[model samples]
Target: MKGEFMSLILTTILHFAATNIDDIFLLLTWFLQRDSKLKSSHIIFGQYLGFIALVILSVIGALGALIIPQEWIG
Candidate 1:
C-alpha cells in the first residue's frame, strides 16, 4: 500500500511538471525582464487564468472526441 501511494504521488508530480514545463520558462522570462510594467501578482493571476482556460479546453476536446463518430474522424 505504501509503495503504491508513493508511485501515485510521483506520477502526479511528473505529469504536472511535464504539462507546465513551458509555463515555467515563460514565467522565468517574465521575472527576468527589466523595466516591465507587469506586477508579480498580475503575472501570477494571468498564469492561473491561462491554466484554467487550457484545462477547460482540454475537457471540451476530450468530450468532443468521445462524441465524434469514428467514421467521420477517418
Candidate 2:
C-alpha cells in the first residue's frame, strides 16, 4: 500500500513537472522582462486564467477517457 502510494505521488509530480516546465520558463521570462507597460498583476492574472483553463480541459479529457470504451481507442 505504501509503495503504491509513493508511486502515485511520484508519478503525479513527474507528470505535473513535465507539463508545467514550459509554463515555468514562460513565467520566468515574463517576470524578467523590464517593460514598463507589463504589470505584475497582468502576468499573474494571465497565469491564473491559463492554469484554470488547463485544469478544466484536463478534467474533461480524464472524464472522456474514463467513459470511452477501451477497444474503441485502438
Candidate 3:
C-alpha cells in the first residue's frame, strides 16, 4: 500500500513538472519582453485556458485510442 501511494505521488509530481516546464520559460519571456502590453493576470488566465485545452485533448485522444482496435492502428 505504501509503495503504491509513493509511486502515485511521484508520478503526479513528474507529470505536473514535465507539462509546466515550457510554461516556466514562456512566462519568463512574457515578463521580460519590453514592448509587451500583457499583464500578469492575462498571462495567468491564458495559462489556465491552455492547460485546460491540453487536458481535454489528452482525454479525447486517450478515449479514441481505447475505442480503436490495435490492428487498425498500424
Candidate 4:
C-alpha cells in the first residue's frame, strides 16, 4: 500500500512538471527581474491562485461531462 501511494505521488509530480514546463521558465523570469515592482510573495500567490482556479474548472468540467449526454457534447 505504501509503495502504491508513493508511485501515485511520483506519477502526479512528473505529469504536473511535464504539463507545466513553461510555468517553470515563466516563474524564473519573474524572479530574475531586478527592478520589477512584483514581489516574490505576489508572484507565488498568483501562481497558486491560478493553479487552484484551473483545477476547480477542470473538476467542474469533468463532472459536467459525466452528467451530460454524449450526443450533447458533440
Candidate 5:
C-alpha cells in the first residue's frame, strides 16, 4: 500500500525492517512522532492508514467471533 510517502519511498524505507506488519507499524510510529514536522496532508494520510487498519482488523475479528459454536453462543 502507498503511504504518505510514495509506494517506492515507503518500500525503500521499510526494506531493512522485519515482516510487513512490523515494518508498517515502525514507519507509522516514526511518522506520528514527527507529526509536528510533517504537513497536514501527511498527518491525514497517516490517520487514514491507521483507521483502515483498525477497520480491517475489526472485520477479521468479527468473522472469527462468528465461528463460535451456536450452543456456546447463548
Candidate 6:
C-alpha cells in the first residue's frame, strides 16, 4: 500500500510538470526578451535546449540513485 501511494504521488508530480510546459517556455521567453532576443526562433531554441538539459539531468539522477546507498530509506 505504501508503494502504491508513492506511485500515485509520483504520477501527480509528473502531470503537474507536464501542465507547466508552456509556463517554462514563457519564462524562457521573458529572459530572452531582457536581451532583446525573444524572437520566435530564439524562444523555440531556448525551449528545446532547456528540455534536453532537463532530460540529461533526469538520466543522471536516475543513474546516481542506482549507485547510491538506500540505507536511509530502509
User: Best candidate, TM-score-wise?
Assistant: 2
Please identify model 2 stretches exceeding 4 Å from their true place: 34-36
Question: Which predicted model would earn the best lDDT?
Answer: 4
Tens digits of per-residue lDDT for model 2 on 1-71? Answer: 99999999999999999988898889899999937899888999999998899899999998998899989
| Candidate 3: stretches off by over 4 Å | 1-5, 34-36
| Local accuracy of candidate 1 as per-residue lDDT tens digits, 1-74 | 99999999999999999988898898999877724587888888998998899989999988998999989877
Residue 62 CA error for candidate 5 (Å)? 0.3
Ranking by lDDT: 4, 2, 1, 3, 6, 5
Residue range 1-74, candidate 6, lDDT tens digits: 99999999999999989988888787765776665545676766877898789889989988888888988535
The sequence of per-residue lDDT tens digits that candidate 3 reaches over residues 1-74 is 99999999999999999978988998999877635477777877888998899999999998999999989987
In terms of TM-score, how similar is model 4 to the real structure?
Answer: 0.72
Q: lDDT of each model, Cα atoms only?
A: 0.88, 0.91, 0.88, 0.92, 0.72, 0.81
lDDT of 2 at 38: 93
For residue 57, model 2's alpha carbon misses the true position, in angstroms, by 0.5
**Ten-residue region with minimum lDDT total, candidate 1:** 31-40
Clashes of 6: 0
Q: What's the distance in Å from true for residue 57, model 6? A: 0.4
**lDDT at 63, model 4:** 99
Deviation of model 6 at 20, angstroms? 1.4
Q: Model 4 Cα displacement at 20 (Å)?
A: 0.8
- Which residue pairs of candidate 5 clash? none
- Candidate 4 lDDT over residue span 28-68, tens digit each: 99888735578888889999999999999999999999999
